[model samples]
Target: MNIIVTRPKEDGSPLKEKLETMGHRVILMPLLRIVPRPRAFIRKLPYQAIVITSANGIRALSGHTELKSIRMLTVGPQSMKAAKEAGFLKVEAHGDLVGLATHIRKTLNLTAGP
Candidate 1:
C-alpha cells in the first residue's frame, strides 16, 4: 500500500516510519507549517475552558503562562498530549470540534461565564 501523509514533517515522521515497518510505502507531504509568532502580553479573560483544535495551537500557546491554570479542551489525543506537555493540568480530548463543543455545552452553563 502507498500512503501519503499530509501532516507536518515532525508529525508525519513517526507515522511514516510505522507504516514503512508495516510494509507500506509512505510519502511525506506536509500540508502546513507551524510558525511561532512574537510574544504577546495576554490579558486574563473570563472563560471556563480553553478550546484548542490543533497541536499547533498548543505549541503556539505554550509560551503563554496566563492560560496554564485554565482547563483545556483539545480536538484529538495528540493535541491533548501536547497540551499536557505544555503544562496544562486540566485537559480534555474530543474526537472533533463538534464533539468538543457539545461536551462544553453540556458540561458548562454559558451564564456562568466559563
Candidate 2:
C-alpha cells in the first residue's frame, strides 16, 4: 500500500522509515516549516508553563534558555517524547490539545487554555 505522511520534514523522516519497514511506500511532504520568529528571545519572558503542540515546536523552542525553568506541557505522547529529547525535564503528556488545556487549567488553577 502507498501511504502519505504529512508532517514537517524533520519529523517525516522517522515515519518514512517506519512505514517503509512495514512494506508500504511512503511519500513525505512537510506540511509545515519552522522559521524562528524575529524576536525569538521574546518567548524567554516568564510564564506559568510551556505549551507544546508539536515536536517541531519543541525542537524550535529548545534553543531558548527560558524553557528550562517552565513546566513542560505536551499535547501528545510523541510530543512529550520530543520535549524530553529536547531537554525538558518536567514533561507532561495530556493526550491532545483539549486535554492539555484542561490539564493545564486544572493544574495551574486557571480558567484559560494551555
Question: Which candidate number maximizes lDDT?
Answer: 1
Given candidate 2, what's the lDDT at residue 101? 86
lDDT of 1: 0.87
TM-score each candidate.
0.84, 0.79
Our tally of clashes for model 1 stands at 1
Pairs in clash, predicted candidate 2 = none
Q: Write the per-residue lDDT of candidate 1 for residues 16-99, one digit (tens) a residue.
A: 999999999999999988777888666677878888998778888898888888989998888999899999989989888889
TM-score of 2: 0.79
CA lDDT for candidate 2: 0.80
Residue 57, candidate 1: C-alpha displacement in angstroms? 0.4
